[model samples]
Target: MKQLAIAASILGLLACSPQGEAKLSAAPEGFDDSYLQKMGFTVETVEASAIEGVYQVITDQGLIYVADGGKMLIGGRIYDITGAQPVNLSENAIRQMRQKDVAAIDGEAIVYQAEDEKYVVTVFTDPTCGYCRQLHNDLQSYLDKGISIHYLAWPRTGLQGSSYEQLKTVWCSDDPKAALTAAKSDKRLPAARCDDPVDAHFALGNKFGVRGTPAMVLPSGELIPGLVPADRLLNTIKQSQ
Candidate 1:
């Protein structure tokens, strides 16, 4: 995993007013604004943490925390230990982020709509992944349960070689749905090209921390990292609702 360095510049964030008490209206009082740039993130939002003096920093890549007047930088999930049971606040925030990202899609996916759709989920998949192939094979099971799937290509090898070309062909074919199914079954698609959204889809998957294919983003914005059985997935979606 690529770890982001959140050292010196985070102190400036910590020194600012508490997350809820004040919004981060400006950059830290004395820290170089370039720290965020160096870290390859732009400030998506800055809010207060459950812990005093710590600020929750929501970035494009994910969430992080800063505390002790920039002396401490914490990455990964944060739990609210105040209640009877610990609450994963960081995961909650990430879910909201994922929901927003998925909702922002503007018809860039190859959709397998359920005739009597009761639920919908966004999927990031690669034709070459075994689990992705399995999911493709079982797509109808989901549809049978009124679960619509929106498929977005995230070719793991990126836009450089065979995998990329295969996925692009799938996207560019006259019948994208059939092409996807064939490709996942290891059938060769005729060479095709167009202004496909494959790259954009991959970029979004990367931003969402997708390390593997067949990543499903539920209606609630929670991500399931691998293949989930159709019935179980339906139950999971219902439980979420």
Candidate 2:
């Protein structure tokens, strides 16, 4: 099966909910793991949000918006009704969660730090991706502009076959940056073995709703997917600041 289909299959299992009037909680009772399972949520953590009558729930599938009592689940995006501009509540929630989760991954990431390190961004990369190769080539340009790049693996082919092995080889290299450059330049690494964090990174990328390589996560939790030029990226960082 394809990577997208495999991801969707995992989500399908968590979509099965009991057929009945779903109850809502009056107060935040926190996330009840068993209750969430019964209601078809592969529960991970539930967090209180600024919005009343709503809770941000993190499940194995991804982030979801649910009512206080865990009724009326919204799998997609949510918007704030009372606003001059339409505020994407779901996007904001996901951004917050992304920042928190990505922060925890700082130490684990293969980092390409800038000398000054004015801005920090996390990239979900796949070795086999063409755009990812382009991005890797311009890594120095970003560094020159004081942008620190952190890499997290997101194999386009998921945890299987040559794609997985290639990523493992890169991660296992004594100098990962050199390994990545060689791989991107069509010089394949020799067959090697090691216990790699490729699976963990792939899982995290999925949780962050990363459907493709070269997806970037800014410090403010906004997602920018695809190959963004160095100048444009600098402008974005400035705007966010």
Candidate 3:
């Protein structure tokens, strides 16, 4: 689905006022900023959902649903039951947020664009991940099939550790593609430091529901969270087209 379409779908589910304005209210006293922040929400706006005791919150991080006025949080999919066909409200919102957040990281991504690109995929990758290495080895096949691959670093370990430092060295290198290639080959990069997007990439990946390396975001914004073989990946891209 197009980015706009995905966004529209999310908006469709959110309860709106009669004035056609999004309701923004402060969360209850106990459900203050710090509490929500602990649950990964930097709450910007909060609105009452059609369902009582549930509120839809828009955060700097992403959209989320909370209960107990914000004490409880739901991070996975939510389905709307009133429609002819059930609508995956939460997943659609996540996809829209994922597209927006991923787009911002495109410049930071290590991209391998096909000469005649027919499709584009964003990948969350980890250098130490075995499956990620296998996927990287087949980069040529993907490019040959006219699939542009954009890679965002996702150290399984949180920032401020060895994995973060390794990714930093790769992104900070003069030739990031070469550095990534070497790192994936189990060759260590020289110790280096610079303003890196490692933290941002890792955080964004988490927000996008990336629990593992080699996770793929297709052109339609559908997320596939495992390593897919070259042939199967190519077929998926073609089908999306």
Compare the candidates by lDDT and give the number of the best one: 2
Per-residue CA lDDT of model 2 for 1-241, tens digit only, reads 2543433553442222112333333335654444455544456667665567767777645676667476445445567778788888777777887899899878778899999999999998887899999999889999999999999888887778766778889888888878877877878787666777787788777777787889999988888889898899999978864
lDDT of 1 by residue, 1-241 (tens): 0224333243222111111122234544443324443445555566667777777765544566766544455655678898999989877877887788777874878999999999998999888899898888888999999999999888877667777888889889999989988888888788888998787677677666676788998998788889999999999998876
Candidate 2 structure, TM-score to reference: 0.80
The clash number for model 3 is 0
Give the lowest summed-lDDT range of ten residues in model 1. Answer: 14-23
- Model 2 ranges off by over 4 Å: 1-31, 38-41, 49-52, 81-83
How big is the RMSD of model 3?
9.4
The deviation in Å at residue 199 for candidate 1 is 2.3
TM-score of each: 0.79, 0.80, 0.75
Global lDDT for candidate 2? 0.75
lDDT of every predicted structure (CA atoms): 0.73, 0.75, 0.73
For residue 175, give model 2's deviation from the true position in Å.
1.6
lDDT by residue (tens digit), candidate 3, 1-241: 2532433244343211112222345655555455554433345567666577777776644566778856566545578989899988767766666677677778988999999898889998888889999989989988888889999988877675766778999999999999999999989798777999887777666556667788998876678888988679989877754
Clashing pairs in 1: 11-70, 19-48
